[model samples]
Target: MSGKYIIMFKDSATPEQIQKYAQDVSSNGGAVHQVYDASIKGFSASIPDAYFQQLQSSLTDSPIAVIEPDGVVTTQ
Candidate 1:
């Protein structure tokens, strides 16, 4: 069940923090493919099913925003 995820950091998050998180994801067997800094602050990564839950929890716990199945918009 490996998939891509879009992780958006808080406006208050620093570059170092984002970098650290990316490194952590890579260390945990996830592949970080793209990083956004202008007009958006986030990174796109491919996470393996084995580490998906853990990685998701890690981001949430760290207060990093995680958006799954990216590129979809819902309007009410």
Candidate 2:
């Protein structure tokens, strides 16, 4: 499933630190599809909810939240 996510890492984080976040997600069963980003806005690739929640407190800056392409929702 395609999704639009906003991932803002800790501004205080170093390049290695940020890269570690991405690696962590992939290692933890989260598949990062793409890091959709532009000059104006910043966002990360598509990862599972597990990945999103994992990088919460670690982010010294604003937390990254998945805005679109939400998790699989069942409608009955």
Candidate 3:
């Protein structure tokens, strides 16, 4: 039940912290697709469902702002 997701960092998150978060994702069996460091201090990755809750809990003291599922948009 793994799915693509976006991990956003807080406004005060430093570049080094962002880098560390990305590495954490990789080490946790997640695939980092893209990193948005300019306007959005965050990254897009695919994380396992089983690890989602654990990741959130582990980042309780981190700069993680939010974790959201990456969804496709449609134009009508």
Candidate 4:
């Protein structure tokens, strides 16, 4: 199942973590369709659902990622 998801990484994360995420998204058959960094907390990325969980695990806190199924989408 291919789809779009918004990943909001944890603020406490290190630079290396963020870099890994950017790299992961590309190699995992996912592209960053959108990115929003209005707040210092973190940024959001539109990618694939496959990478969502990995992102969640990569965070040390309760970082959230918007998961939208194939044809489903929602805005913040």
Candidate 5:
């Protein structure tokens, strides 16, 4: 089972750091969907259930800020 996630980075995170993180996610069998560098610093990715825990742990231990489910958000 794979789920989408919003991996937020610190406002001060460098582009290199973000890119590296994205690469790490891909290496872990995840797929990056979007990357925001201005105003918001983060990337949206689809991560496999198997590597989800490891991803959370890695992010928690890194300079990243937060991680949350990228649940569908629709405006009526």
Candidate 6:
């Protein structure tokens, strides 16, 4: 079950680090839509469930802040 996800890096994350992460995503049968290294240190991508765990584990002790599903926001 592949799905859209938002991968946010910590403030200490460098641009190079972010780029490497993007490369990892793309190499692992994922599609990176956007990378935010200015105002935000993160990226939005579509990752497959089969590779999600490996991706997360690869970043262990790294600068990654959070990895969560991308979803719509509603205001009512």
* RMSD to truth, every model: 3.0, 6.8, 1.7, 4.8, 1.7, 1.5
lDDT of 1 at 22: 87
For candidate 5, lDDT tens digit of each residue in 12-52?
Answer: 78889889889987898899999987778999999888787
* Candidate 4, 1-76: lDDT as tens digits: 4455555555565556655666677788776654545563333445555566666565554444333333455899
lDDT for model 2 comes to 0.51
Misplaced by over 4 Å in model 6 are none
Candidate of highest TM-score:
6
Best by lDDT: 3
The parts of candidate 5 lying over 4 Å away from their true place are none
Q: Please, what are the lDDT tens digits per residue for candidate 2 over residues 1-76? A: 3233555543344556546666766686665555543432334566666655655544545433323443456999
- Give TM-scores for every candidate, taking all chains together and pairing residue i with residue i: 0.76, 0.49, 0.85, 0.51, 0.83, 0.86
lDDT of each: 0.80, 0.51, 0.87, 0.55, 0.86, 0.87
Model 3 scores a TM of 0.85
Predicted structure 2: clash tally:
1
Using lDDT as the measure, name the better of candidate 1 and candidate 6.
6
Residue-level lDDT of model 6, residues 1-76, one tens digit each, is: 6889999998988889889889988888999997776777899999988778887786779888899899898999
Model 4, position 4, has a per-residue lDDT of: 56
lDDT, ranked from best to worst: 3, 6, 5, 1, 4, 2
- Which one wins by TM-score: 2 or 5? 5
What TM-score does candidate 4 reach? 0.51
Q: Which one wins by lDDT: 1 or 5?
A: 5
**Model 5 pairs in collision:** none
